[model samples]
Target: MAGPTAAPTRREPTPDEFVAMQQSPEFQELRSTFRGFTFPVMIVAFIWYVVYVLLATFLPETMARPFLGLNVGLWLGLAQFLTTFLITWIYVRWANANIEPRAAHIRQEMEG
Candidate 1:
């Protein structure tokens, strides 16, 4: 009876090959779209969060002033919740538009 055949050798990719994969146009395009959406959104979200903190810290009198019978701080705090939902919605929409198609394209290219 013949023994089981030896398993084929599987070669790991080299560092240069990994770097080449990263620097490929398809990968670069994916990185560009992901970063473009994330960085801007993150910067804006951080700025918004900082502003909320500063207002709650240094601007007590103004934040305590009434708007629609609720203090401005309360309304602004509520606005933070709204902002979170809004940002999530925007990110999903942006990902669908700018990232998903490119990712799917790259996946198809890889698999095919």
Candidate 2:
């Protein structure tokens, strides 16, 4: 009869190891790719939101224009929801295609 098995111990990476990992080309590329996508998207999304708010606040007349029984402001507000879903979908697709594989490889390398 076998005794109870011990759990495998996880080795923690040292700070130096973490620093080296951060300095690695693969890690650098991953960071660059992530920033490249996120920064622009964030900027554009912020600009879009600001534009919407400014229009609603300063140009109420324009926003009050009606179409199909809905005000333009209502449509723009709903568009924010649509934009959120669209950005989420786009980011998921982009991450699956670009970010995930590299991150998985890095994780495997770190684990091993």
Candidate 2 off by > 4 Å: 1-10
Q: What lDDT score belongs to each candidate, Candidate 1 first? A: 0.86, 0.93
lDDT by residue (31-92, candidate 2, tens digit) is 99999999999899999999999999999999999977999999999999999889999999
Instruction: Give every collision pair in model 1.
Output: none
Over 22-68, each residue of candidate 1 has an lDDT whose tens digit, in order, gives: 78998898898899888988999889989999998999999999999
**Which ten-residue region of model 2 has the weakest summed lDDT?**
8-17
- Judged by lDDT against the true structure, how good is candidate 2? 0.93
lDDT of 1: 0.86
Q: What is the C-alpha RMSD of each candidate to the true structure, in Å?
A: 6.3, 2.8
